[model samples]
Target: MKIAVLGTGGGARAHIAKLAALGHEVHVGTRDPQATLARTAPDMMGNAPFGQWLADHPGVALHPFGDAAARGELVINGIDGRNAVAALSAVADRLAGKTLIDYAVPYRYDPDLEHPWPTPWGVMPAMEPVDTDSLGEQIQRALPATAVVKSFVTQEQTTVVDPASVAGGDHTMFVAGDDADAKRQTTDLLTAYGWRDVLDLGPLVCARGMEMYAHLHSAIGFGLGQQFGGHFGIKVMR
Candidate 1:
């Protein structure tokens, strides 16, 4: 399976490395392949440069956003939260009819907020379309031809690709989307990633709850004594 991951961030790298290790052809998408490779410093979150990470993982192909999407049978939108819609909209044709597993949250960082929630990284970013709409629905609206599944947002990047790291993978993962087939595809991938429980939260609208949980997710991290982010899991007890 050729999978397209549209971001060079740490979270994206987690998926990229795991996919490659799973024997799939991983096509990593970036704004500019050359610029990404030219980076000598760490990213905003202090993750190593893409070039350095790529060096350790061989045989994974790197290409511009559209090219990577075109090469993939399944597409993963790991683009920056704020820019995901615009970047993905530009490659609409390439992603049409494909199962797009969107894990990006629309986080709006405002420094001049009257009341700011501070975090180890600076300020806790406010999420857009959080209550009424969600990034998943926005992406689905932008690409009507695409089957978009809302997933991986309720997870930390590390635990997303490796669920067993926490409580032996007893926790639950959730998927919400209008297309049943798309949700199934995403659940299949989660199974590949060793997720034991993946709940179908029904339609895409449920993503509002998932996206809003981002704030609480961070708070839980803080409570756990994680300076920046925490590695934990949420289990829905029956």
Candidate 2:
């Protein structure tokens, strides 16, 4: 699969790592493509000089914007909620008829919000309420021709991927989208990345519940330990 990952955050790096591991040709886009490529190279292939490898493999290109978006068979948005729309706006047209996986939430950053600062029990104060529709909806509205599916927001990178490290075998990851084909594409992608049990929670609106799941997980993490990386699964009682 020719995969293009946007943004330069941990979430984007996580997608890049998983996609590259699957033997897919991955193109990464960020504000500083060179710097982002350098940082990700370490996490991607250990001591393999991935940057030079990418440079050597002219077929595999890591570009800034248009090249990355235009060439990808599948596009993934790994940007922060705040910058998600603006960051991906450039490639909206290129995404037409493509399966675009959206992993963005709608968490707002407010200075007036009062939570806890740096303390043993770290806590982020509540800010303005999220749209609940998620940045994905906005992107979908922008690029109507492109199929947008929302999934993987309920995880903390550590848990959604390689769930064996924590607990529960084949942990479940929720998938939501309006388009069937797009949802299938994301489902296949998730399974390839090691998520064995993917729960299709139905239409894109379900994403609102999934986003709130993150907020709840955050609170739970504060109560448990400072570090919060976990996932959820539905257990049906027969």
The top-ranked prediction according to lDDT is: 1
Model 1 regions more than 4 Å off:
none
Clashing pairs in 1: none
Candidate 2 residue spans exceeding 4 A from truth: 34-60, 114-132, 228-238
Candidate with maximal TM-score:
1
Report backbone clashes per prediction.
Answer: 0, 0
Q: Could you estimate the TM-score for every candidate?
A: 0.98, 0.79
> Model 2 over residues 97-185: C-alpha lDDT tens digits?
89888877776543453444443434443422345555667778878888888887777764554555544544567788899999998
lDDT of 2 at 212: 68
For residues 1-238, what per-residue lDDT tens digits would candidate 1 score against the true structure? Answer: 9999999999999999999999999999999999999999999889999999899999999999999999999999999879999999999999999999998988997747889987877888888876778889999999999999999999987899999999999999999999999999999999999999999999999988988998899999899998776899999999
